[model samples]
Target: MKTIKHFLIALMSIAAFTACEKDGDLITLSGLEQSELMATESTVVLTQETSAEHALSLTWTTSTLTVSDPTMLAPNVLSTTLQVSASEDFSGTIQESVESSLSHTYTVAQLNTIAKNLGATPDAATPVYFRLEASVGANMNPVYSNMITVNITTYEIDMSIGFILNSDQEATGATLYSADSDGEYVGFMGATAWYSFFLEEGDGTVWGNDAVSGTAFVTSSEDGSWNCWFPGQGGCYYVDFNTNSQNWSALWIPTLTVSGDISGELTFDRPNVKWTLPFTATSTTMTIQVSGTGNQYNNATGTDDEAAIDTPVAFAQNGSYVELVSQAGDITVTVPQAGDYTLTIDLSDPTAWTVEAVEGSEEPVVVNPNVYLPGVDDGISGNWTFDNALPLYNEENLAYAGVVNVNSLWGYTINIERDNWSDNYLLDSGDATSGTLVFQGNTNIPAPTAGLYLIDVSLNGLTYNLTALGNEIWVVGLDDQWNFNMPLTATATAGEYSGQITFAGASPWGFQIHLDSSWNRYFGGSSGSLHYRGSNITDDASLTAGTYTMTVNLIAGTYSITQ
Candidate 1:
């Protein structure tokens, strides 16, 4: 016969029972919050002191009793059952909420394992409270203890700085750290951020991130700030704050200024202060002298302005000086050694000096008009109207007075300077206008120095033999009236040559070779021929005073006459 034995128990505060025979030894049990069944804590506070992020463990110790050994305590046969529940309140939620009511019997080994897995050592304070639970069949119960508290702390840092959104090179900023009493910064770590600046005048900026550390401040996007730094210390620098969520504090770096003047403490013997000047003159003679306040007064070789002009000017240490005498025009000087020097010149009256006398303190005296004496030519003087556009013909070689008439088609050598100019006719460098006009010798004559000249003409490749035509002079005039002497001459021979004789464009008509005395003129044809093109020849009426060449063929020609 089977007898039902009611085993009374508790599971999480609920009462229950299990049926079993007295001799069956089924070991019916209730859940146990504490393995040995003794508790001291009734509440737990999971304070901020818990460094561990997960759950905490609770435990207790007590001697157990068995039904069979009513007088003996069964520490050897300790049996246990457990139930668990979670709560938001720090109070005994394990009793208020019955998460699990079922009870499972635990062997002595199992009981110790449960306590060990819950982080319960022999006597660890384990300052968290959990309800003691017991179960038998469906019955549940909870046991409570006094309150226990735990302390835990967390770490946080604050960082602050300005954000440079636009990476402009001209815009500069700095990251500054708050300094301690000893000038050291607290928690000052490394930093990194991107930066960019212009590579060229109009190019896109180049950029990269840079990190640095110190109690000191750093410039971000350092640019255009007038500040001076040690070489290679400026430009642009990016920063990276190596900490988490911390802002990097910064400031726009201000620029600095430096100033000083060059002085003459720099002596010639110590270290030379070199200087030079460039110029051109009309005559072969000129004068140079250096005279100023400080080093200019020094006595030097080339510095003494005297006569017998020096080829390449030189100056020695001395007092200030001046150019008393020197070459006429421009002089170029290249200093091999260091020194100070000055230059000057005195230009002789150019061919015919035009004096625009403004009434001064003393009414300017007007000198007598001088006659133009061309060497080896008939001396003539008149108010000739001169064309300023002709190529450079050193007028110094031919002096003219009066209204100089310059009417002809002639290539110009154009150059203008405040002083006596030279034959500078070629176009300036990099000038594409009118292209380049090269002479027979590849000479680029821009504007020639202002002057007067005798125009010499050559036919074919040979200059005409002036003596062959009876020592008689023929004046080639670009006028139908034959009124003016066109400063023309000819030396001739015969060969294959191509050239254009340029006359002043002011002269309107074609060319006319007039016989000063009488002579035969020969041109394009067979031997001893006088050929005249229809376009070039007109009425020879103006030759009423001289002999002329006939257009018809000359039959037995070799003839010469003498008085």
Candidate 2:
């Protein structure tokens, strides 16, 4: 009886297993199907003028999702999204917006801005591609639609007409000067909305005026708020203003003409003959003596006084008018007495230039001999003070020369006044030491690298040069016991060194060339041609055990090893 009961239970278990298999088969046949989205339009065109009114629309069919269990009937929420991309592959500049309804619409302006934000040019028409995506429940499969292409035209602001400068003194449209696009017009102290004044007509006139105590010109709206105006009877002008710094300059359209005489007899000419006036920091007045053997003056004629009578002469003159040759007025100078006479010019007022005769002296102007290396980082801690500064003496070459141990790199300016940083000499182009130096507004000179170097500077010529100095050269390798102490000495010849060494070590042995028993300055490489402070030879040469001659050109910074 117990066995019969057990057989009945087994039979019941088999029946239950058959029912489960049949249910699984039904579920597989009725599995959930993924739905796809479709777009209403394949291509779209948009214009910048009416971008807000135009839009690209996309629509898609709803998707149906199913569950494995037939008894579990839960509602599935479908979420749809519209995506835009610059490329068909959707790899670059992609934007997506969630769709609440079956269709999504994007304004023309919105699409154009999106394209620009994704790296499209502002003024050009861009091709934009769009696609739709449909997603069911978190566990259900998502679907994608066919891609659509849209062409968007974007417009750029006309910067030429954005800002204009017009004065009440000038007729409407008669003298309307537009503002220049001189970068973003950053105003005084971070001010904004200030544009630079430019000329719309008549030689592109602009105004230049003092920012402080300058006249202000109002635009069309005279509501008490006005733009800065150019002082002095307004013709055509260019007004340059810095709203952030509150600094402004207004100059007449046509620059003022300035011409002067050298001895009440010589008249100045534009672009041809002009005296290059020299001035010192402390002197409120400047004097140029054009007598025999004095501060010589030249005219259209050559430097020779007798030759300069009828011919044009070129005189070195320095002032604000160096580039204003076209606008300066004719200036004349007359030399009454041929004897040594000094033409003293007053610098108090630029408008009224006066020259008077003074007694001339033949004494040579004495320049300070001691030169200090100011504004230099000497591998030490300090600011631009002269304390602990490097001093250079007048060498035989008439230039200040000295040897200095500098940091890996440094920048410095030269100065004759030991305590004054203002009276310093700097390079014409900042950080350029290859050219001549200037007394004012010069840039810092750079040191190529850290090492002992000989620095030579000529205050008179305003030029400088630097040379790296090395005391000794050594060749070390396995044959030299890999010790710097046991190295071959190089014989110096014409700024170069050459040495020969015998290598009896293993066929492939590493070797290097060092300077002064130190590795700081060394050269080693696979190529026969060497580089200063370059990498070492990783691949050892399989030279037969023999004597090899090595030559190093210190001045040229090259080396070679030959068997």
Candidate 3:
């Protein structure tokens, strides 16, 4: 004889549980008062004397099912339960079945026990939430009443402390707990870039930066003190706030590179605050080493993120999402496969940073093209129209010369970067024939006439020689590798000629005038005198290393150097 009781019990609750109220069907909750559970005593103070006394009574009414047959009685198929919680939302609750009852009475001792179990502190009045749950046949189709609150004061005991922290004082914030109730509260807070905040003790005391300059000080309980802040990137930090000391501390983690057992270095994404390196693992898995400077223990001072950490690294470790420690840490995030992958270290958040491994092939390496100066040759451009410029001649040593096709008389500027206005060069003195050159100088030689010409400019000695290409006077001795040369315009008297020259060079300077590019015939003599190769003429006393005006009538044998 196989028993049928077991089978009937198993299928009783959900047995075709449907709304087909034909002859004798269950029509649950047809006419019930739509309200919350009600408590007779809304508040109570539990004591040893009142331990046995009734503290509170909770009652709720719910209809099981309604049917058309008036002669039939409602079946006792519905079950009710009593739920009590110390939270308004009842995020955590304690449930006790009331069988088929409609009301439950709690004694002082029983109510006190429930409150303490729900984390309510003794000797303080804490609000507890209560509601009734009605269901038919093994908790199917459960219906709940509105929640009610009952404030109860229990006996005394030790409870941990907590402090509220906020980005804005009057705005939303979170709480950090102190297990020992010692004023020091700790919690995980997301500190973002420039996330200035404050902390408030349970007694309504506010704490913040002490407003001191260059100090790791904090305000004891000042409402108008400077705002508090995180020292470094402020990514997710395991933060600690000490209400007594008024100071806070967290590891100062500086931005670092991600390397070790990888192909190359990763580039940092400034906008996203992350570093991503893509590569395939060499073996079964990949290892990453993140090593950098950080504060080990002491709170960072003004502008010194890790003045105290005072080491290459304070703390670190392996595994995903490792809390940054204030000691030497060896961190290696997981990369299961050895194939292609892109590893990323995200530090975008001011509160914390994260490491992630993404699957991918090798990303293309970008090569930035080189930037070159504009090319200019005298014939095509820069002939004098500002269309092109005369730069250093064939990368020569300050010998700026260009052959230009000129229809009329025109002047040109010279610069390494052809178009750079700040560095452009011009004649500082004299006419188109010859003169001194100065940086940003605004003078140009109005050459006697313009045809195909060679504009040779040397800014080293601040001089330029505009020669008619055919007639050129090679003035030597200005520079060892160069010449103190300038073109001399002829006079109607032929051998008796006059010209002007401006000279500047190192100390103990002298000069020799050559008639042609050849060193065959030269004149070396002091001012107002002339000599045919008679010992080199020198101005080591007053004329050397100084700017002077030199005017000479070579044939008349009269020259003057005016300082």
Candidate 4:
């Protein structure tokens, strides 16, 4: 009863362990939510002057701060015509109660001063306006603040015309003339100048079209201000002059040429060129054909005027990967791999060509590979032996009757044995004349001649003759105490041998009887052993005694003999 109780407890403990192992896990919670903010718009503006008593300060903030103030910015007349000073915190002359929110009112004096500077009169006909605009955060956000345009009679003058383009100037000696100040261009060959004149009608101003002739500088009087004038029905005008000649000099911009390394003694027909500006080349074959014109190019600044002409040429060889440039000929190159690779050029043809890695190159080049097979027999780029011996071959049928195909018969369960392995070597029976297994070694030993040889044995310390040309002999009834040393020999002798039979001990004595043909023979003796070497060649050949010539077939069977 106690043993049963113990077993029950063990079973319960096993069940508990299994339950704990299978139920060891807890629920896990995981997840996340994300929200994105858009980029804001960046803005720029120019102030009329730094004369306002209530100095304005521009404040900006962003999640990623990388913005610069006006004071820290460089002046680029080409990119921006207006210059803006740094913002100030001081508010001057404005009413004390006007400070609130993002904007404040200016005094009448400030407004008049600003207007005069902007070339605008205080009257309604030439009223000035206070312009207000907002900029995006420094994070390059796509969002923008509301734009404010307030037209007030009391306004500050804006000295900046905000003209981004420069006017063309014609000069002759000390005199310089500009087409923009002329109000209207003299008009192209068949063009005309026209304007919309303001007409007094009703309470507001009305306009009507008017055509005028002459080169007098006239602006659009429709708004009573110096606004640019338009010519023709479409209000587009162009300057036309028939001067003898106008010399405009431009700088020559250099183009870069890029190309991949090419291999072999080949030529790259077409190449390409790339420049900082668009250019049209003199030839269509030249890539990146585009033209660039500007005053910055007048003195041929930078690498202008210099052009690059590069093409891919190759002289591929065994070890070298080469690419040629059309401009510069024949440069040695090395590629990572052998197969198809590309040549990248800056100016010349950007495309690449397919190349093959071959052997026998004109130049001596070496390839350093990470991994390579050592001492191989197959042909490749590594060190492989070429003088190794080939499989053995036999010319004459020596072992079998008649002409023996040594290669076939020698391979037929043939083996060689030697007491000392110091001169060990394999005899290729296939290379023999009469299926004679040739012995070879690293030492200076004479190679065995190819011929038919019969394996013989001397019984009782005497050379015995085979019953047939290729027969095996075995002696029976020899005393174990006889001192007969067994000597196995191979010869072409044809005769039976008999002599004093001797043995060392009780150890059984035996000799191998090999046959040249496919036959079966048998042998058994009292108190002795018969070990036949040839396969199925021992059949007690029961060969009758007589001077008869017969084919000693390998298969075992007795037959009558005649002489």
Judged by TM-score relative to the true structure, which candidate is superior, 1 or 4?
Answer: 1
lDDT of 1 by residue, 1-563 (tens): 22123212222112222323346554333223333423332332222122122223444443233433232222222323333323224433332323232222322222222333444333333432333433332333433332334321211111222111223323222222222222111211111111122111001111212112111122222333211111111111112222222222211111111111111211110011112222222333323222222111011211122311223222221223212112222223223333332221111111111111111112112111122211111122222222222111111122111111112222233222212234223322312113332222223322222222222212111111111222222334333345434322322411111122233322222344332433233221112222221112222212233333332211111111111
Error of 4 at 62 (Å): 35
lDDT of 4: 0.23
What are the TM-scores, per candidate, against the unseen true structure?
A: 0.15, 0.23, 0.31, 0.13
- For candidate 4, report its TM-score: 0.13
Error of 4 at 389 (Å): 94
Q: Candidate 1: worst 10 consecutive residues by lDDT?
A: 265-274
Q: Order of candidates by lDDT, top first?
A: 3, 2, 1, 4
Model 1, CA-based lDDT: 0.24
Please give the distance, in angstroms, between residue 33's alpha carbon in candidate 3 and its true position after superposition: 33
| Clash number for candidate 1 | 114
Tell me the tens digit of each residue's lDDT in model 2 across 153-257: 555522222123333222122121124644223111101112123222121223322221112222222233333322212122223333323343332222121
State the local distance difference test value for candidate 2: 0.44
Which scores greater on lDDT, model 1 or model 2?
2
lDDT by residue for model 3 (1-563), tens: 11332233334434213333334543332443343577898888877444546888887776646433354434445556787887777686675657456678876656776787788888888988888776665535567888888888986432233334443454223455676778887755544433456765543356777654333335456654656655434343445678777677654444445666664655544324455677777665555666555453344443344354544532254444544444435566566666778777665442345776777854433211111112222334544334433333211134444433343335545554534556655667777567777777665434446443445566556776654433334445653334535555444542333355545553223566565565744555543454433323444334445555455444344456666
Best by lDDT: 3
The digit string of per-residue lDDT tens for model 4 on 72-161 reads 221111110111111121123211121123334443334344434444443433322222222221222222222222333433332211
